[model samples]
Target: MVIEGWGVNENIEMVDRVAHCANKLQGWGKRKRVKFKEDI
Candidate 1:
């Protein structure tokens, strides 16, 4: 039971990390798009 709980915690942490990365990428993309528009 303890092992199962630990596994669940690890999965949650992984998901959080992926979500954080995705948000960062999205923000970066938005900034790039805006810059491109201004350059045109």
Candidate 2:
């Protein structure tokens, strides 16, 4: 998941995309009763 050697804008976009996906998964887990414990 590391945005290695990427430009500033690209790095931000990558982070935003990951956050968005994580949020979606979090919501899905809530509905399905799946536990998503933080790994770090």
lDDT of 1 at 12: 66
Tell me the TM-score of each prediction against the true structure.
0.70, 0.53
- Tens digits of lDDT, candidate 1, 1-40: 3333335445467666666666767777899999999999
Worst 10-residue lDDT window for candidate 2 reads: 1-10
The alpha-carbon deviation from the true structure for residue 22 of candidate 2, after best TM-score superposition, in angstroms, is 0.1
Error of 1 at 36 (Å): 0.2
Residue 11 error for model 2, in Å? 12
- Residue 27, candidate 2: how far off, in angstroms? 0.2
Q: Number of the top candidate by TM-score?
A: 1
lDDT of 2 by residue, 1-40 (tens): 1233333355368677677667766667686664444432
